[model samples]
Target chain A: MKPEQKPDQQTLSSTFALRINGADLVILVLTIMLLFWVYNRLWFKQSSGKADYLVVQIDTQAPVQYPLNQKRLLELEGRKGKSIIEISQGKARFIHSACRNQFCVFHGWLSTPGDTTACLPNRISIAVKSHSVKDTEHFDALAGER
Target chain B: MQLHFTTRHDDHRIALLAALAISIHIIESAFPSPLPGIKPGLANVITLFCFIRYGWQTALQVSLLRVLISSLLLGSFLSPTFLLSLSGALLSLASLYIVQWPFRQHLKYQPTAIGYALIASISHICGQFLVAWYFFIPHPGLFKLLPVFITFAVLLGLLSGIITQLLINTDTAKI
Candidate 1:
């Protein structure tokens, strides 16, 4: 056989020999198994109860509470003039605000016990606070946890 | 007869492969994912095949072409989704190239498809995660999906590797 044909021979041999090796297969399997376990622990498992209230706080003033069962539109004052919050179907959202960035308005809704939306520029924030201390601490007080 | 693999042939082959990859990408995207940020990434099979048969440049061209053309077809070009896809492709390509460095140097070490695929998949997810955190969400809360994304990557990477290996073993493969 000519030397020019050696490259083709090598390629053929390489292709014929290609298979999933044991070590790599085992690693992949183990990694995937471990990751699935972690994912289930973090997200898939369920907890009970809904949020008790939507707590809206502006600046240093007292926090305002709205029961989750009630659906209403709140027009509140913020550092950047008027801000609008809407609560419906057990969810609260910062729908509109005068802040330039509109970060809070884009945050969508706070439905879960620990969900939160804050407008830093407007010095306004909303938190879904559960009445039970255990539930509250599990999500809300774990500020540095994430 | 002298077989001249000219630039025109290369260009035509690249275009054909890109079309194949783009079709696969779009079809996969149409399937509803079980979880957010999880994808089978079957298109990377074409990239791996190109890298092994042609070279890094061809592989890069195929990948970028797939991303660009597919995103345009999906109506997500220049959007955050497009940015995420671009970043993921770049990082995976970088990882594939890194794994092949030793072979390029005439070293005895050679990474198999499984190894390359695993590394590329993990890097792809990491790249997308970082981009999502830094630009789209800008919050640590995004980390909540890390484990899910990573698990999917490993599973999908291994799957793609097996598929590529099977294809390479076939007699009909152009390579």
Candidate 2:
């Protein structure tokens, strides 16, 4: 490779040639701050408290939401056939399904907020999300209005 | 007559740079990172510097040697972690080549060392993440980790780039 210019002689005078300038530093700082803010918001921000519910969706139908405090067995219609899901102790899973792989069954439990398990062949997806206290209070207010 | 394109001197230069990169790789691995997938990847500074000084081929040689030798030392050879490292190195090299292509041919806006570092680092993380997601985890939740990975990449990328720039500008960087 031909030497374009000797670093010792040419570079000293042109120190800023490849160096990060003030503008670049400012931009970098801003970008990092923005990213940290976003990451904190997405991953660290607690939604009132721990997740208190499980949402089960099958195919294109509306999702069925359940309070985690209650324990029950739910049967849902999947694309291929029916699936049996179990909810117990604020966690849920696919106990039985017609799908061949039974991947969802092996996926174990969904207990944490943002945890999800899905069996595509069966078209059933389950997610754990926080049900805020305000929504519960709103529901209670609606009942009182009646 | 066979034309000797790369001389004996070039081979020595390549070996020297590769050794420097390998040392840095092993040393960086010793430090524990707060996050599992987050690392400063200081060895990439050598790759970027070599690319600017010599060319892409030399840069590739140095990076691949570093990954291979370091993994062997770390006892992760042929393991899933080794595969991830290999993929990351290969993708970073490929991206470096693509990024420098225009600058090599056209007198377009000359990309700074930071540009090369940023592009290569991001591609490296992406390559590793894709392999991890597809082979190791295979979960949609893996996508959630992308933002953190990218943020770390950006931070480390800029840092390594500035260090490379300082080394180059100070005449301390040796090819």
Candidate 3:
């Protein structure tokens, strides 16, 4: 065998290795496993992420921002009367509302993104929110409500 | 006075391949990405071809030249985007060099384009993120994005690798 034939032998794989080799298979498997781990890690962080803040939106007024981790009480004047809210343990809740049925207060604690409670009659609402720019993704392919 | 530059056969090959890579780069840039810094990097197909057919030197020339010319055309020269591009190209080339170094003269296991692509793309994004976090955004929060970026790198890397393998395996690939 001439030395010139060696180059051709090398190019044989380049020219005719139509079937993927074992190395290619291994690399593909490893890459897919990596993607799986990364997806699990990132999606878990995303799904389990807690709210960092609370926003109180009064009727036709600028929403007031409050930290979730900070325990505090807020009494804001609404359309009809005062609505009181409380923040504690990284959760926010409507403590008292000047509504007929007290529905907002009974709605319980809000602790994640897209969680909210509103006193409809008083036109006041408090929402648990997180300041993550990565919330752009939807829950499912069908664009289910988050 | 007739002054001209002498060139090798490989030089013209580099020019042609670089032009091809640059065109692909420009067309790819027109795409809208779901997130910044994520791209198919289709131009790498040309670079990988040059690497497998010619050599690492040719691949390096084509990749670097593509980044430089494409950035200039895209009006991002000397900017952060250029920095990321240059860094990613350099780091991926270095990784390819190391990977090919072992199989230089061998009769044993041959690492295919898939392995090289996986290594190259992952290290490429790692280098880019290093530059981004260190020079541009020095925040611990940025590290949270590492897994996400790497995930995309793996996916895109596999895609480009399959394309490269097909190109290499084709009978007319010698051209």
Candidate 4:
């Protein structure tokens, strides 16, 4: 780097050096705002005053509703075998399953409305719901019917 | 008749960078993701490095070669995973190229490694999501995870950008 050289020309090092400048700080602020927005959206469901139950379905059977606030150890029968789900407080989780992988069991607890998990091999699935059955069509639309 | 092959200095540099990125990619794949389609993408530091210290063309070569070779090594070639990797790489590179256009005339104010990396990672994840939605799972339900993905992209992209900056500022980064 020659000190006496004219500053008119563009150099690679001068142009794209990753310094802590105003532009970087501005971007950082924008990213943080986006993160907060996403956090708020996800958090909205929990306190919507309607998130109270979970929907459990074995294979193509009609979905069954269970209150998330009620503590219960529920056993469900599927094609392969039986699975157990534990619901307590405002959260529910798969404690036991017939599948070898146990991905659903490892999925921990689901407490958010619209959250879902499935034991593909056992043909059992669970989804957290926030609305009444009459609004299930809207719910399914929101859930993408997955 | 004997065939002779020539390896230029640029070729050697590209190979070295691609190998570094591929190693990082392979190591990253070994980690279990809490959700599908989420990765730390530490390898992108190399891509960012190439883009800045070397040039756009060299960066492109390193990034693509890392994708191809890593897919082949991971045995996910031509699979959905590979497709996601390809789209992500292409989109990120394109974003960097486009983002770099205006500064071509000037030395200062060009978005540096931090800016470049943030855009690269964000576009990379979006490209992956688009591919996943279009080809594998068309469920809009998948989009429910968008916030989570974007959040990770932003956080990880910033971290990667910072790391790249630190890397370049080091004397040994001249390599």
Candidate 5:
């Protein structure tokens, strides 16, 4: 082929290639989107119900435990620039903190698994662990100890 | 005669264009984003190519077809999400066509790519806002987020344009 013809040939080929690539890209995107939508619609189920256990671990080597009561489970207070963990509602959370974010306070009550309230400034996390009602034996084992 | 016959074959060219465009769309969507409803619009590179190579009509057709196919595949068809995609695609096409027109004479390929990309990004955001206002989110207060959305759009659009420009430049050089 002549040099002049070569440039035109290349251009034609590139154009064809780019066009094919575009079409394939569309098909792939559509397929993925469809799968995601179907999965989200049919399979992704949000959990419901309060957590059975609320675990609050302070910065210490050992985890502090509080009894579960209807009210005043957990509370944290800021004293002299130190975070004080106070379990008031038989659980623990920040009752008062000097931290700027106050994220823990806003976290409110997380009474179920997959629920978490955190105070990032204070490096505090309040989370709930759930036990199913069907697990009555396990529930009794834990509750009996209390 | 042989060269003319090979180049004029419509099936090969059209199929290739459609496939490429769709593939870009898929890739863009597949890449995860931190922010919900934000996309790089990777497929738009093909639309830009179409705009340059074919015409506005072909570009529009490719864009709309990509949106429809992607939405249906993603299972967002006939949903609020589909509407958002459709509106965004239309708006982007309009912007691409508009910008491509006035500057076609003076601007080089890269600059034209950049200009059209920015316009498309802005138009996409506006389309999203309109959809939000009409269908799901009726609150006028949602407009407050426009600046943040636009900023993200600009960044994404620029990146996309740069990549497309690189590809086109490479192709030109090879030719």
Candidate 6:
């Protein structure tokens, strides 16, 4: 009889395994370097901006309020030219205006950074400016007195 | 006659391997991450196994099939997200293919698997950043959150690697 042939299964599996192992090693090293680069770019280096205060400007031709009150719904109603800025309840917003788009109305209220409302039709704008240190301290003193 | 028979056998082996890789991909996609874009990438473990057990061609097939099938199933086909997945998979596979040589001679399967998994994870993130820059964010500076991405990658990669190592250890023992 011809010499008995040992099954080649082990040889095949081992050969395949060795080839795969080699590929994996190369992938691992390259990935580590890439991750290091991403970490430095995305995480370690970030920007920080300071806080600001709020300002509101309204056109004289626009509607004016004798006295701004939270209790009133503060509707501009049918008045053609008017703008109103109201600050109460620890937040600020343009309560009502005669602008057609009403984007200023949609701005809602602002208590934080970069908040602004503008009625382009009436040439009125309300902006939240970065609060100075003195303003913050004064606000804090007012809170303490209360 | 013997050569033809061996070629047929190799073809069968490759088909079986591809099927196995797709199954793992399905399972990985079915589970959602708590974070919007995170995944354990359990499928990569199988791709790694195939890359180690068969060859680069098989690994490439597995990676492509996994991305295609997973994207289709997840309803992300034809979307930017699908493109991101494809880029990530290709980068990962390329990295794995390149690192296989040193791993075979000097490292145990566990360490090698861990190292490769980490590399794949990083490559995947880089691919994501490229896509985000092109399609979503215009400025590269917007991706300054690289630390957050890297931390997440390390944690997820370590977990995937550990699981893969355990499976490899068990499979080797059976053999």
Task: Give the worst 10-residue stretch by lDDT in candidate 4 chain A.
Answer: A133-142
User: Candidate 5 on B31-124: residue-level lDDT in tens?
Assistant: 8888777778778788776776667877777777788887777788887777888888888788666656755675443234555566677678
Report the Cα lDDT for residue B135, model 5.
59
lDDT digits (tens) for residues B66-128 of candidate 4: 999999999999877899999999999998888778777764767767877888998899899
- The DockQ-based CAPRI class assigned to model 6 is incorrect
Give me candidate 2's TM-score against the actual structure.
Answer: 0.60
Candidate 6 lDDT score at position A11:
51
Per-candidate TM vs. native? 0.59, 0.60, 0.64, 0.64, 0.50, 0.53
State the DockQ, from 0 to 1, for candidate 1: 0.14
CAPRI grade, predicted model 4: incorrect
**Candidates' lDDT values, in order?**
0.80, 0.79, 0.82, 0.82, 0.60, 0.62
Model 2 agreement with the true structure over B1-175: per-residue lDDT tens digits:
8876656877888888888888998888889999887899899999998887788998888888888898899899988878889999899889878866856865345466776777778889989998876666654456678888888898798888878887677655344
Cα misplacement distance, residue B148 of candidate 6 (Å): 1.6
Model 5 C-alpha lDDT versus the unseen true structure: 0.60
Second chain TM-score, each model: 0.91, 0.91, 0.95, 0.96, 0.82, 0.78
In the order shown, the candidates' Cα RMSDs to the true structure are 12.3, 14.3, 9.3, 8.8, 16.1, 14.3
- Cα lDDT of candidate 6 equals 0.62
Pick out the ten consecutive residues of candidate 4 chain B with the lowest summed lDDT: B135-144
Runs of candidate 6 with Cα error greater than 4 angstroms are: A1-41, A44-146, B1-7, B101-111, B172-175
State the TM-score of candidate 4 restricted to chain B.
0.96
Off by over 4 Å in 2: A1-114, A117-146, B1-7, B172-174
What is the alpha-carbon lDDT for the whole of candidate 4?
0.82
For candidate 2, what is the DockQ-based docking class? incorrect
Interface RMSD of 3: 10.1
lDDT of 1 at B20: 88
Q: Can you give the DockQ of every candidate in the order shown?
A: 0.14, 0.11, 0.18, 0.12, 0.02, 0.14
